[model samples]
Target: MNIRITGTGSYIPEVITKNADFDNHEFLNPDGTGFPQDNKTIIEKFKAITGIEERRYLEENLNTSDMAILAAERALENSGIDPETLDYIIVAHNYGDIKHQSFQSDTVPSIATRVKHKLRIKNPKSVGYDILFGCPGWIEGLIQAQAFIKAGMAKKCLVIGAEALSRIVDKHDRDSMIFSDGAGAVVLEETEEDGGILSHESGTFAFNEAHYIHFAKSNKTEAPDDLRYIKMNGRKIYEFALIHVPSAMKTCLENSGKSITDLKKIFIHQANEKMDEAIVKRFYKLHKMEMPKNIMPMSIKELGNSSVATIPTLYDLVLHNKIDEQKLEKGDVVMFASVGAGMNVNAMVYQH
Candidate 1:
């Protein structure tokens, strides 16, 4: 019944888009006039708040499945496991394969199936599917893999989170700066020891769903006709994370029979550096303990928000010591937490 992540891999697109790359002219007023703030001022304010300087975007011809396959291949190699041995392949994503300049998405065959095909997985028993759990999709996939292993339904599984968000994002919207594309994957296998994944918790607050990110048209008359873009109520999401995310992590730790004092690191969703910091600080405060600096590692400054890909990618970085000044040792207790669209929040406790 024991489950552990044996290997991790991630692939970020080579194209880097900096905050300053956004043009002020794109954000026009209702009357087709320019916005008050110049591009420089907007970039500064955005970086000051989100702590993001740049993010990667998939190549024009790339798709979510392509990134997922690349990451999965690396993970399989890293784990020393053959693709034929995998019993399940779970992909976490909201948008499937989306072509450039097209609003349509392909989801019928599922991105997991495409990933399986690209990886040349021949085992008929290795089922592939997708999960839609908002930004917590990747962590949710991990939770599902744990369930499968615990149920004796599978011995090995591949969990991947990939997104080609850049294709769907409306460049004219400022929120587009926070969306990017990347893929991260982990190979999970049955373990004899009780250490790996200890506990997990996930839920949704339907009332807040309307306030978070959603596809909608621009309110300005001058905006492109019939174009949909990602829109968000920043204040609402910030408040939701500050209140709900910490509570979810605390509950997860408590469920695992562990406490903040027992944790070595907290890998949070790379949504916003400031929001993540606040969430962790508030979580520790609830236990009447001061938040430890460096406990919560973040990559939002360079990776932006790739939704479900954030946790696994960050985990892979820390495991390989790619994260500056941060590394995970064997038997270390770590927690993961993420909150976003779906008004969904999730947390998991794992022993390294």
Candidate 2:
């Protein structure tokens, strides 16, 4: 069964902070790589370390729905599908419009209802569900849509990967520098059009220690705030990507009976610009193929990592930033690789 992405969209917050503003920060260092000297210092150190020239953080009152709504609206618009005719929506977000349970009671229905009400659809019925996976969530959600559509449960589905990570990031920690709030959505519809999602196979390693990041926090004073936020083994993660990601990517391609060299555009989680260069370079060297001149990396000098939003954001960036006619083509293979805390790794192949 082929599940294709027909339309894509994303949302970035409004507030922007610059690295130069961190000049007098307490943590600002003469060398620039050092830890924040103080709360003020972190602003500078964050820019220097993450290579983020500037970043957006949502206002305190904002939530995932605020960003996701914009992203979803754009996706619907780009799909050229009347919202009235849409049949399903799957949100792959860690945060929600209201509390988690509010989806059944209010939030999710409200999101779906707004489409019908705004578009004035005569028949307004669609299934809405939430798909949650770490950074791999979007690809996983895409696969889930394929399954649902294959089962004849839906006609059109919207998958969103949104996060208000800064809300949970421990302000005092170094990892906070990379956490940001954002959302991206892919609109999928079943069609015999011959140019949508083609193949998707994904796997995850179940080791409890495979990945580690801030789990949720409880009022209980058991674990400290630092433990409740982002935790990392940056070097180990790089090592894992070099080893496991290649294996995973190959597994997906092999399972789908396709070759990596045949892919027109390779999309990996944009963890960082440096990581992007290294990972793709390593893979290219191992494959004995000339480095693909067509690779489109969306990582920027700023725009600190947005986790699951990273890949879809790359798709949006490629569509808007350049004029490369050879970049991505209809029916061409698109690859996705995601590795995050819990060491969970997922790989999938999509057809444009």
Candidate 3:
């Protein structure tokens, strides 16, 4: 009774937002103070730190659910699975269907329901729901799907991570440069495959870390408080992830009974380029091993941080050979890990 990922898909929006696009953004500090340096200097520093030169943005006519449906369609097609056979459809998202110029989220029906409807999945037993666990939502959804399969509750599940952060970003905030929009999905099924999901771990640190990433008023002094946007304490999140994410990944891998050297790839959340590298380095250090070259593949350079979409999207690209020099061969061991809002962290060990 192995729970395996049979197929993968992703929707990377066509709109490209380059770092230079922010040159005229009138960026400001959270406290409403102007930066001492010009936008050029700020953008340069941002690129150096985040390793993000550009990011994808959803077309104005589309919403998060639209992308999720697209990705889901591809995943089902890739798996050669029947939509009617799916027992669960889980959507991992933070912001729902926010219009291009609107800040309010429209989540009347869960994103999963919307995706199921759009996908034309008519099976009533195909339960649809949404989960909000920050950036780690997608991985958590995968874990949930695995649990259901393990418990004899479901045989197949569709897990999609989609977000339209561009629709909710505060253009006045410098951190907005770190966000974009995209969606990724996978088909998980009960199979007799030799390699599948091995083990997983998850945790929430809500006491003091609850507000590390939260909604807040615009950084502009005169902006209305009623209209809020995604905000975060970048320094706090960086420190927190560096200290905890590696530990969680190590635990998950160890639980899988695989040695650190058995790991061929690590699909960590595309948060910050530096933070991810440090986390993997620390993970190897925990086992007294040096980080291997090309063990980590990144999509943040072009996708930015699409919250829950990062890991699955990155995995889809690599598994499909869309990413140069990154490949996952049969029998190879891989790990998935993420950390974000909810102050949450999660990881999963899998075999290809």
Candidate 4:
């Protein structure tokens, strides 16, 4: 059996946080000393590198599960698929539903289960679970959904990537500017058609795992704060993505029996605009081909990096022609790629 993406949807919170909003906030060093650069200069530097002008953050009352439910509802409606017919609901997230201000999280009742409850899905046979493969969680969920259908274990599946990353980010850390909150979802159905997910490649560089994002205790001697917040070695991750992501994309396209000329669009994780552009260029150069302009679409300038939700949300936007210059026609070959916290990288080839 082949698996096809029947529908796609996404939800971004109402609150828009612009890069200039950070101008008043002060960044502190581990020792409590203030950073030399002011917020204005910092924001400019971030824009120069990440190409992010603004991002959306969940409101005080919303959580990851809430966003997932909204996106999933839209996806199901778009697909005209009955909730009862869904064989699986896979929610990909890092920080589960965290209560506002409390920082309390509950994963016992998985985010997927919460989404299922919100959707009022009554079928006990329809399983709900979560995947935590870092930023590649959603793509991994899609890969698993395809496997289930191919094995006759499922017919239709809902894959969602939701992240309330704003809640987990340290307001004083510059990394806070890079993460936002949102959700994106897709409905996958078993199809006999020739178009669907064709091939995928995924791997982890465990050695570099320590260099990526992680939660750790504050090391400030004067502050002595106990709160754990998301921290990362930005330079190291940039290097890693520049080196490994291109190889992963190449391997995936080769495995799918396709080449750069066969691709319609490359939907990459909205991590950083400069890094993504470099990776795509290197990918084509490896094949001795010219870099195709307008082939790689990006939304980081407006959406920032919502972790796993980036690719799916961008995909949904492009699919609906919401993106100004991007278009996808039936039978188009699209590729998805991502790299993040797990020091993991993944690429998938899909036929639209």
Candidate 5:
């Protein structure tokens, strides 16, 4: 049951936000193209505040699915898989192209139709679906695709994770700076080859839900109300990751029968660079050994958190930047992890 990620593609909107733009706005220019003009410079204060040099977004009113469709096309093309040959499609998105998309809606899969209709995927055998999770989404989609393929139900699957954090954001809130709109797509097809997902692990600590998450307040047909939008406790998030991610990361490594020493590099959720260091520090403390020099923590800070799209975009960015030359390699373990709104925590080990 080899599931190879043969292709990777991502879409970022054209708009670029600059520090000078922020200077002119009274608020943080919730659209977020510029830095604060009155009190800050892009150099000293802005980067320190957001850890972002520049962020990207779709033009105003462009929905998430628009970005999704583009990413899907690129990934499909990159994989050399015709849309007409796709057996299944699943969308992992916090929101979609529609104004207020339904979670329970088969929109996940039906999105394939929109992709087909918009992108002209002519696959008659394709059925589309969706999954709900925040940053942990693409990993969940991969798990689902592996299940279907292993069951002999499908030959190939297009697993997409798209995010438009910009939609639910509160413009007045600085916390909103943590989000951006982007989408990523991967073509996962069954393979007889060895290098793909080797082991998977996940845990949901529901007790943390009280501090951070989203809940539906109205009928599924109704658009999300203000309260239904995503809510965050930045303090709680920092605290949760610093404490729990260490244990969870150990589990992912141990279950895969690999030690942190065996990995060439570690790629965890790029939530915050500082937070990733804390996890590495814990590993150092536990073993009385130096953390792997191969570990490089990153965040999509300028683009905000692209939610489910984070990992794939990160993966693509890594490859584009020649992560291999930087020392991530085959047979060496690559770690992927995310903690999201269900109070969920998950990590997996991959043999590159």
Candidate 6:
């Protein structure tokens, strides 16, 4: 029996925030020191490096779970599967439901349970849960689904990655520009198809990299210390991903018995454009080959980094022809990889 992604869906927030929107904002360093350069110059530098000119923000009335539910509904509809038949619903998120202008994260009932409830899945057998593995959460959830299906614990699962980073980011920090809100989901189930998940890898390097990403006081020194927002050492993360992510992808692809020449596409975490390009370049280098043209699909240019939602959203877009000149054909071998908070990293090889 093969475990396959039967359907996929994504929710890209309607709010479009262009870089020009931040032209008048006060940007500050983590040390609370003001940059000598003007905001326009700073934003231009940011755009040059991250290749992000715009991103999406969730509406104030909706929460992370709402986005998950929307994506899940579309996934279910695409799969044409009865909700009652699902054996599991797993949601991956970092900050939970943060109401508009609210500083607190609400995760009491778990995002997965909230999504299941909102999706109106009434079957008691359909267990719901959430995993907080940073940006890699969705891919990890898919790996877990594969295990459950292979172990005979479940045959059908709904895995979702959603985030409302706009609700949790510190406006004063430059990193805030890299974050946006979005959600993506997939239905994984048993199938007799010839190809599905072939191999996967996961790792965590918390001994020294633990604090690479964490919540702390806003970059604005005058802000109350009692309230904190997402923070990260961007340089360290870029260097770390460059050295590690490519190797992980290589291992996953090799384990799948697929050659370097066989890879048709790669769905990498939409963290940064230069970093992603560098990582994929090194992966090809490892195999003693040059990186293939258009081997990777990127949504970060428009959607920004919506944490776990990146890969699935990109995949859904490509599969639906929403992205120009990017599509997956049957029997195409693709790789999914991500690295994020928890200082975590994961990769998976899949065949369509």
- For each candidate, the alpha-carbon lDDT, in order, equals 0.88, 0.65, 0.94, 0.90, 0.69, 0.94
Q: Is candidate 2 or candidate 4 better by TM-score?
A: 4
Worst 10 residues of 4 by lDDT: 216-225
Backbone clashes in candidate 5 total: 11
For 18-75, candidate 3 gives per-residue lDDT tens digits of 9999988899988999989999999999999999999999999999999999999999
lDDT of 6 by residue, 43-148 (tens): 9999999999999999889999999999999999999999899999999999999999899899999999998888777899999999999999999999999999
Clashes of 4: 0
TM-score of model 4 (CA atoms): 0.97
Give the worst 10-residue stretch by lDDT in candidate 6: 113-122
Q: Which candidate, 4 or 6, has the higher lDDT?
A: 6
Better of 1 and 6 by TM-score: 6
Give the per-residue lDDT digits (tens) of candidate 2, residues 130-195: 665777787788888778889988878888777766656543335556766678887888877765
lDDT winner, 2 or 4: 4
Model 2 TM-score, all chains together = 0.79
Candidate 2, superposed: residue stretches over 4 Å from native: 22-51, 97-125, 208-211, 216-227, 322-327
RMSD of each: 1.7, 5.4, 0.7, 1.4, 5.5, 0.6
Q: Which structure is stronger by lDDT: 4 or 5? A: 4
